[model samples]
Target: MVKTKVITIASVSGGGKTAVTEELRKRLSTSEALYFDEYDFEGAPDDLVKWVEEGPDYNQWNLEPLKADLESFLEREEPPAYIIIDYPFSYKNDKLKDFIDLSIYIATPLDIAMARRILREHLKKTSIEINDELDYYLKFGRVAYLEMENAIKLNSDFIVAGTLKVIDIVDAILNKIETL
Candidate 1:
């Protein structure tokens, strides 16, 4: 049985990773694509909320559970199973080296990401809560950005310009995967 192809879109908070991942997922959903947000681990939502209300120390805890889930997903035997993962892979873990088939790093200017975050905050119903979250993200996002840069330089298959259209980025990634 052919192993499933896994595509990871990684970047700092406010980067277009989620948007690109969502668009790719929508396009490939008919092909039975499995969408996974690394942050969707047990207690992640609560941690995220806490981080928003308080600060970034919350994420400093272990991420082994999330890594385990990713490893399991990658090891599954299923052909034509496209998994789009939205997460920031910074650490030099064995799992990171093993599971990722194609890693696309979205490179955007910090100001641009901030602007996008502001827009996203405006679109949210809970503006206060979202703003708090955004604030925390904005502060710690820089560190994530640096880590992401290292990760991308070390493992990425491609570094897409963040200004490109989502469709174009998706197409580029799909094309690369097809060749492999």
Candidate 2:
């Protein structure tokens, strides 16, 4: 079976990874996309702090099924042209190393990420709750992002500024793919 071209768009929360992935989906033909945030893990806690600090073991994720799902796609009669994963944890997953043809890091700074996260998440939350959320993110999310940044940078094939317009990022990636 021919191997599918797998791409990972990784960044911390509110880093515009979703925007880039959405743009990619719209622009790419015959593409299958996966969002890590959408994954349903049986024993996973809703608590972000515990999930981040406890690391991979304590955080339950049904990723084995994803591996199989990806394999199924690759083995198909006409395999998908691309598989894009918009998630932060790809750096830590060795299983994906062989599958991923390219890794793109959306390098959004911490302050920008915080602003975006607060803006996106504050809709249903009260002001006080939003403050608490920011605090929690500052304490735990920042730590997790910091810990993962170096590894992600080293693994990435391309580093794009996360603050750029999604269309620009899309154009950059499309051009890069054409060259490749």
Candidate 3:
């Protein structure tokens, strides 16, 4: 039996991973794209906002749960021919890394991400206070960017831009998968 192919689009908070993943979902006729943010939380008292604020480590507190849920989902459904996950995958999760067939890292410059965050805060009418939560995310973003660079060094595919063109990245990954 052929194993299902899983493609993950991962990056920092404002790296356009969702945009790329959504475009990939639309472009691929046979694939089902899953957004980790939309996954059910199963009555967890704290919401994502709380999780982002109080989590011990980014992966242990936030990303690990998502990875576990995703792994369970994959096992239960066994999914469509191709599965694309739109989430930031921390390098700490080796099990999650092992499950993916291809990982695409989307990277934008730190300055660009900061600008995007400011714009997002303004649009949402939220305070621009640099609290622990903001600091944690900022640090995570920096670490994620560095990890993505290492992933590229390890031959993972990547797209770097303030504004990414998803179609091009999706097409390239699809073509590579077809040839493999």
Candidate 4:
């Protein structure tokens, strides 16, 4: 049986995790990718501030759905050579840590991430909506991003510059994986 290597790319919002995962999947013919945001995980907090204040337990966001999906890939008779995931917590979540063969953190500056998020997600929003989002980021989102980044960065096996082009980031990841 072939062992499918799981590589998780972690980053704050708009920090290139998804982009890297997608590009990596394209480059590796025998690979598939999963995204954390694509699932509605149970136990995820409704309020970001409250969660952060309450110790921001990474496990609080139940990753069972993601886990199940990951298992599906692993359980396949002909498992893909690589399973790339656009995940945020890296190995922080105890439940999912065992399955992760490699964890990568994308260290994007917060300001750049915020700008990208605004442009990508809020471009069609009214000024008031944009302002509201920015206000929320200032008051709560920044802290949450920092919390996740600091925690994940410490646990990741590799770190990449989020400012790099997606292809460059993917190349770095591929080179790192090849060395392993």
Candidate 3 collision pairs? none
Q: Estimate each model's TM-score.
A: 0.65, 0.84, 0.63, 0.96
Q: Per-residue lDDT of 78-114 in model 4, one digit per residue for the tens?
A: 9999999999888889889999999999999989999
Candidate ordering by TM-score (highest first)? 4, 2, 1, 3
TM-score leader:
4
Candidate 1: stretches off by over 4 Å: 29-61, 71-80, 122-143, 150-154
lDDT of 1 by residue, 73-140 (tens): 66556434677777565323444546667777887776677778677656755867777766776665
Per candidate, the number of residue pairs that clash is 0, 0, 0, 0
The lowest-lDDT stretch of 10 consecutive residues in candidate 2 is 56-65
- Candidate 2, residues 61-146: lDDT per residue as tens digits? 54665667778878888998888888665545654566888888888888888889888877788888988877876666676677
- Candidate 2's C-alpha runs over 4 A off are 1-3, 42-62
**Best lDDT among the predictions, by candidate number:** 4
Candidate 3 vs 4: which has more TM-score? 4
**Measured by C-alpha RMSD in angstroms, how accurate is candidate 3?**
5.7
lDDT of 3: 0.61
Cα lDDT, all candidates: 0.63, 0.76, 0.61, 0.89
